[model samples]
Target: MQAVILAGGKGKRLAPYTTILPKPLMPIDDMPILEIVLLQLKKHGFTNIVLAVGHLAGLIQAYCGDGSRWGLNITYSMENEPLGTAGPLSLIDGLEENFLVMNGDLLTNIDYSDLMKLHLEKNALATVSMYNKDVPISLGVLNLDDSGNIIDYIEKPTLTYKVSMGIYILNRKILDHIEKGKYLDFPVLIKQLIEENEKVVGYDFTGYWMDIGRHEDYSKVLEEFNSIRDELL
Candidate 1:
């Protein structure tokens, strides 16, 4: 199977570190996050990989030359301008079947084989990997009626949502929704699919997953990596 990893983002949220290296190259222990992702994919039998790169593309290419160390083949898709998330797919070639597309900075224990199995079984146009996230409200919350009277009140309640893990298994036909050189994001593409009555499945994963897009997440993953290294590798 083939995989496309979106590693082009400037990662402004992780500024100081990203100033030197791309977010995908940021170390989680001694290994770059993307290296971990590649090793995991290689373990799962994905040999052909495409790295979508922009900011500091040279450094990434230098670090992961040919993917020979992991026994995988890698190709680079250069983005001259920011193409959002989904737009980069339009620039790649030979995606005739279903492929896995994910953000490069992810740290997760998701089984790629299981995700592909579900995608095939459902015959979905796109299968999104979802993670349950609980966001806590630090302040008091209130519910109001139509007349603006408070019907209920609560304090520091946590809201749970099945959020995108920034991972997807998409059929090649999904590429039709993306325009060449357009800044199309995943949410917009998914919304377009929904409006067009396309089947978009969400596979709920309760395993460990983190985006590692921020400084705090980087630190958290660094602290957690050792314990989960065996599982992720």
Candidate 2:
């Protein structure tokens, strides 16, 4: 099978650290986060991998070096300009009838094969892997009536949402919707597909998944890596 790892962004949110090192190259423990992702993909039976890279491209290429150490065929798709997310897909070639795409700076125990299986079984144009995230509201929330009356008051509470894990399995045909050389984010592409009645679906995953795109998340991964090392690796 094939997989595309999006590693191009400048990782503005990650700032000074990213100012010198690409987010994917950030160390999770001993290995770079991208290395972990590559290993996981290899374990899941993906032989061919394409790294969609832009910012700090040289550093990433130097580190990965054709993916030989990991026993995977790695190639790169460089972005001359910043393509939001899905836009980079337009630059990749020879994608399988179906392929997996994911952000490079994440730690997850999701079964990539299973997610692909669900996509195939459902015959979807795209299948998004979702995780149930509990977002805690620190401030009191209010519900007001149309007449400017206080209808309900709720103290700080936790809200649950099925958030995208930044992982996806997409059908090659879906590429028809993407314009080559245009900047298009993944969410916008998915939303367009849904509006057009395409077979876009979601696969809920109850597993450990976190994107280390922020300092806090990066710190959390460092703290949690050892304990969940077995599960993730």
Candidate 3:
């Protein structure tokens, strides 16, 4: 099987650590974040991997050459410029059936085999991994009327939302919705797929998952690494 990993972040939020080493190279437990992701791919019997790289692309290439050290064959899809989430996908060749794609910096214990099986069984055009998050309102929330007046109100209403875990299983046909090389975020791609009557399913993963985009998130993962090492790493 094949997989695509997005590792081209500038990582402005996790500066300094990302100033020299890219976010993917940031250490997680005994290995780099990208290495852990590579290990996960290997565990799922995916030997062909593509890293869509930019920012400090060379360093990642130097460290993960051919992916043999990790028992996988790694290729690169160089982003000539910043191509958001789905943009770089245009560069990948020969993904006929279905393929796995995730950010290089994500940490999760989702069983990839199961996710893929669901994708094929349901015949979804795309499948997204989702995480549940509850966000409490800092201010009073009001149930509004068609008029500019509020019908009812609740103080500090907590809102729950299902957020994208940034992992996806995409059928090759979905590429028809993508404008090649554009800066397309995953959500925008989803909207297009939905409008076109394409099936998009979500697989809920309640395991330890981290999107190490900011300093706080990065630090938190490091602190929890020891406790959840076996699960996330």
lDDT of 3 by residue, 4-113 (tens): 99999788888877889989999987889889889888888778899999999999999999998888989998888998989999877877578999998888888888
Assess the local accuracy of residue 82 in candidate 2 as a C-alpha lDDT between 0 and 100: 95
lDDT, model 1 = 0.94
How well is each residue in 199-222 modelled by candidate 2, as lDDT tens digits? 999999998999999899999999
What is the TM-score (0 to 1) of candidate 1?
0.98
- TM-score to native of every candidate shown: 0.98, 0.97, 0.93
In candidate 2, which residue pairs clash? none
| True lDDT of residue 223, candidate 1 | 90
Arranged by TM-score, best first: 1, 2, 3
The regions of model 2 sitting more than 4 angstroms off are 145-148
lDDT of 2 at 152: 89
Candidate 1 on 9-78: residue-level lDDT in tens? 9999999889989999998898899999999998887889999999999999999998998899999999
Q: Go through the candidates in order and give each one's C-alpha lDDT.
A: 0.94, 0.95, 0.88
Flag regions of model 1 displaced more than 4 Å. Answer: none
> Which model, 1 or 3, shows the larger TM-score?
1
Q: Judging by lDDT, tell me the better candidate of 2 and 3.
A: 2
